[model samples]
Target: MAVAVKKLKSTSFHGHKEWFTEVNSIGQLHPNLIKLIGYCLEVENQFLVYEFMPKGSLENHLFKRGPQGPQSLSWEIRIKVAIGAARGLCFLHEAKPHAIYLDFKASNILLDAEFNAKISDYGPSKAAAARKYVATGRLTAKNDVYSFGVVLLELLSGRRAIDRKKICTEQILVNWAKPFLGDKKQLFRIMDKNLKGQYPQKGAYTVATLALKCLSTEAKFRPKMAEVLATLEQLVNPKMTHFVI
Candidate 1:
């Protein structure tokens, strides 16, 4: 088993101590979360040890080519990964104090050997501490839902959320794909070309539709993480539709 050691510079120790405490408390207990093995906080050294993910982050798999060659995650694997990450976020949202992930993005999602997804870098302790300091803080679960929608877009379209390489509207993945979300005829145009027409059109469209709801301009309009999980489960296994939401 591999382990990842993240070291914080001495200059930033005090700044990140709260985040470290938060991870130690909440991250270790969640299976779908990256386990925080241990930490070291000596006189001038600070480091966090976590369970290593052999496959690295979903961001790397989605946007960057591997050393050997280009690799694409199959539609099935993509759905599975999305569901796993959703479940993790759901757990965080439903925690005792209702944790809100401020930094939810593809790069923060790690994949194990079998490509099981785990949500990482969510500093629940920090979130809890922040509420005490900022009475007007607007951190909410809906923010995470929006980020999840962006990840879903990445899975479907194989593009980065913000890619400068593409020009104009195409530079932003959401803007580039938004127009096609509602049009079945145009949906195919935005899909990852690596899929090579092998994905189930119905499933792809279903996820795209969900992604749109998650990316709603108004936070209140976004579906709850639990609802998102239910819909995704149904997408993966049509038989699961019988399970009441």
Candidate 2:
């Protein structure tokens, strides 16, 4: 089995030790979370070993090129990744005391050979959720739901969350996409062009609407990860009639 070793700064000995212990405690709790395999906490270097994801991170798939990741993901694969990520976050939220994954972004969502997505860098929430968590000095599971929305938007649009290369209006993905997300007629305008009109319109609309809900400024307005999972399942299997949020 392939393995990946991550190197952390050598100075933060106590921090690295805590992270090492935490990984051992939680890494194996779910299939969708990245599995930590080993570590090296030597005096000069710190390392974390994990199962090597052949497909790499979703960010690479969506934005970068060369050895970083795969070619543009197909519509079906994007939905599959989103569901897998939701499962990981749901597992965290269900913990006795929520193990909120602070970071929920495309780069942290790693994929394996079968295109199954697994979440990495568990304690780093960014974008809007990051702002809320830092501003209020409070972290909640709903914060994770917001970050998930950003990644979902990235998957749908095949765009970076913050692309400095783009014009000012398009640099911040959430801002640019929100206006179109809830409008059925405008939805296609923000969709990934790589999909080539192949995705199901109704399913796409459902996903877009769900994403918009997650992006709601009010933390309480976001759907729980379990509820989000239920919605995505319907897209995976149209016969699923039950929707719970």
**What lDDT score goes with residue 77 in model 2?**
93
Poorly placed runs, candidate 1 (over 4 Å): 11-22, 129-134, 238-245
Residue-level lDDT tens digits of model 2 in 1-245: 77998887876445455666666667787899898887887877777788899988888888877774447888789999999999888987786545667767888889999999998876422223444665686777788899989988998899988999999999999999999998988888998887777787778889999999999999889999999999998898655343211
Alpha-carbon runs more than 4 Å astray in model 2: 13-21, 67-70, 123-137, 238-245
C-alpha lDDT values of all predictions: 0.84, 0.82
The lDDT leader among the candidates is 1
* lDDT of candidate 1 at residue 67, scale 0 to 100: 88
**Compared with the true structure, what per-residue lDDT tens digits does model 1 show for residues 1-245?**
57999897887555556666677778767778998887788856687789999999998988888887667898888998999999899998888777778778989999999999998877655466546644565656788899999999999999999999998879999988998897877898888888777678778889999999999999899999999999998886654322110
Q: How many collisions between residues are there in candidate 1?
A: 0
In terms of lDDT, model 1 sits at: 0.84
TM-score of model 2 vs. true structure: 0.87
TM-score for candidate 1, please give it: 0.89
